[model samples]
Target: MASVKPWSLVLVVFCIMSLSYFVNGAGSNEGLGASFIFGDSLVDAGNNNYLQTLSRANIPPNGIDFKASGGQPTGRYTNGRTIGDIVGEELGVPSYAVPYLAPNSTGKAILYGVNYASGGGGIMNATGRIFVNRLGLDIQIDYFNNTRKQFDKLLGPSKAKDYISKRSIFSITIGANDFLNNYLLPVLSVGARISESPDAFIDDMINHLRNQLTRLYQLDARKFVIGNVGPIGCIPYQKTLNQLNENECVDLANKLAMQYNRRLKELLSELNGKLQGAIVVHANVYDLVMELITNYTKYGFTTASKACCGNGGQFAGIIPCGPTSSLCKDREKHVFWDPYHPSEAANVIIARQLLSGSTKYISPVNLKQLRNL
Candidate 1:
């Protein structure tokens, strides 16, 4: 060949590099993989919208801040993105994991993983009966099992197994409702409290969770990030319902949460040790949330104890966020969106920590580390 001109040679190299970039999907989220989320309203996308239950958030102001739905409610309890949604976005997940009950959850949608969480879901079968309908952990797993079968049909058995075990993260943010709606209800929980001590109830929860995690492992789930119960006593609802001071939280509720959290940490440690090739990481939601509530100013929050959308006393937390609820003009300044859920701003802070925080918040490894593994 004749001597190649310098400009022509440079152009050829640039074309080759551009082709490689497109082929490898570099700088793009091509291989971050799917996320299978399991939990209650905290992580629920829109499963409750399809269910006939008292615990539904498909009305206005619920998703007023969720950009995915163009500010329309998508059955999420919060005003915007949940922790799960934020984590997925930060991890470069291409899209939100479609809710299992959504009409579009079939076909190619299932390949991106599925969210099986419901508004009132819990660990025990009878945990949220007051809601009339909710998918407990057992039922969610059953739904996952069915999803796994669908995966087999779509990608064949071996490839589907590999996809699920290697290219997915099983995130569970449950347990709060088991305490909030089950063991803490005054009239409804009287029978349970009398029949079982707090220790006994926690033991039951642990046992059920053990089986639930084991079941997921058997179904080829190798990565898990289990968020321990947060400081539920500090929620706007708890504060308002009990007439607590701005700085005070319900001691009994916090005590129960800490107790269960301790056991849950131990249980996760056990699972990590016992299960081969499994990485069961713990996300310290309690400390993270408590930090936000205690140092709200540091986190750019104006009010940590009040709900941005509700109708009631000081906290505006007795009533859930609805059409006639008192909507706050400064939504992002409030730590909570309603009585029980965190605002999208608070969620962003928590998600950043979980994604790249130190071992103090996410033990063993943070979400970014786990994703790489």
Candidate 2:
């Protein structure tokens, strides 16, 4: 036998220790479970890559910082992982949830979880018609239903039912596109806004979401974290379109978001009480995002009002992030990555909060607690 050198022994010990720490660290809890993500562009994990829509991010500079794809665009709207991706990571998910439409989202891949999110999708079926082929909440849920059947086939009906009910977490982060692309479209929204009051439109949204959640429950989804609409008014797109100052957001847009958020909170509460053995929690995205935008300095962000990758004047909100877009030198210093999404840095902060923050942000139970349940 050959004798080992002192330096080699030390290096071996260091590697062992590092491996132990990783295997027993924050996400080592046995309760860490599968994450089934559902949402819009904010949490979309490349579902749009398969769609023939104009609202795509599978281009240069979109995922320039996403290490998973070797700095290549993976169709995520932001420069890096979405809040969903970060949350999943912090919770110890071994791999990123595969996009439901990805060619590899089959066989053993479905055991971990699947991402059914789509950019430009909303709670309503007609919300993202402008995108031509975007999958709305209704369609995403339909896809999940198919996945549920697949699970039954893979694990047998009884075992699959138990696995879904006890070992999975479903996260839904949607609703912004309904207002931004439907009720607020300058040309098309004129007719919608004229015909329906904000109250009526919001009511429709609530009704649709209620049915959607109920459908998920019927499909054996027991754990849910539903994030409400964030402050769309403060995004670069709204600020640039409205020509507002740094601190001023589009009032109409903010009002609509707040209205929908209120109703969404009520809906979640109702579901929590009505759905047997279900843990439906509300994620206060509006207030959390508003706090970030209002006191970006506190969060160590240099500019919360501008997009790191976009073109046009001021906040660079007019043009979407694309090949010819103006990319920021320090991507981590900015809050928004594009006109409509938060950068990976901002997403990290938000994901941390959602993971273990107080009830003030994530009502009843935070994500960590939800996972352990």
- Candidate RMSDs in Å, in order, are 4.5, 5.5
Error of 1 at 16 (Å): 19
TM-score of 2: 0.92
- List TM-scores for all candidates, in order: 0.92, 0.92
lDDT, candidate 2, 1-373, per-residue tens: 9999999999999898866533332133465556899989998889999988988999999999999999999999999999988988888778888999999999767777899999999998889889898989999999999999988887778878877888789999999999999999989889889999999999999999999999999999999999989999999999998899999999999999999998998899999899999999889989899999999999899999999999887999999999999999999999999999999999999999999999989979999888888
Q: For each candidate, what is the lDDT?
A: 0.92, 0.90
Instruction: Report the C-alpha lDDT of model 1 over 24-114, residue by residue, as the tens digit.
Output: 3232334457799999999999999999999999999899989989999999988899999989887877789999999999876776679
Off by over 4 Å in 2: 1-31
Write down the lDDT that model 1 would get.
0.92
Candidate 2 accuracy as lDDT: 0.90
